[model samples]
Target: MSLHFDHNRPIYIQLMEHFYRKICRNELKAGDKLPSVRETAVEAGVNPNTVSRTYMEMEREAVVVSKRGQGTFVTEDQSVIQQLKETTAEQQMDVFLTTMKQIGFSEKEILDLIQKRLSALENGGDSNA
Candidate 1:
């Protein structure tokens, strides 16, 4: 429920990202009940319809399943979560690539920089140090 919303994107997209992270991180485990739409709206400081929209989208994506009278729950299918993980990775890579290109870095330069940063991270060093 703790969300730092960017004013750029739609609030519903932000909400969906929050849920996606929670599920991938195992903070919201398989079969765990989602916060009620009203509860999420209150916590997110958004309209109830926004929460509903996010939940509906998640359901359509098979990330969560809504049962009548039982509330929405995280999907029990591990493959769905894995697919989501891959999708998140692709989206992140796309963003990084776009930013690097816009900043005048070529693909090779970006890859080299990413390698260095990853090596620094693995060795517990700061890449920007």
Candidate 2:
């Protein structure tokens, strides 16, 4: 739970994204119980209010559900998880494309770079090599 916070973004949003990445990677499975707010605050080195806000936002997005006297749990719906994965992927791809284009990369160049990286990974070599 060693999260490095980027001060440029809101802490709660970063916390939410951290949890989203965990869920997307299957590290936090469906119906997994999230840590208590106080626990998360301690772990993330943020205020309790930030963790609470993060949990609230996640609930609003239907990414997790809070059970009274229990705790917050990741959504059990597979469709919701699948949609989350797709949405996260699109958001990440959009960011990558925008950054590459900003650096003067054309669409074909980006596509070729991606293909080369994938081929390198498939061949068990470092993509950066």
Structure candidate 2, residue pairs in collision: none
lDDT of 2 at 93: 99
Count clashing residue pairs in model 2: 0
In candidate 1, position 18 carries an lDDT of 92
Report the lDDT tens digits of candidate 1 across residue range 36-97.
99999889899999999999999999999999999999999999999998999899899989
lDDT of 2 by residue, 71-118 (tens): 999999989999999999999999999999999999999999999889
The C-alpha RMSD in Å for every predicted model, in order, reads 2.2, 1.7
Query: What lDDT, from 0 to 1, does candidate 2 have?
Result: 0.95
After superposition, the stretches of candidate 2 with alpha carbons farther than 4 Å from their true spots are 127-129
Task: Give model 2's TM-score versus the native structure.
Answer: 0.92
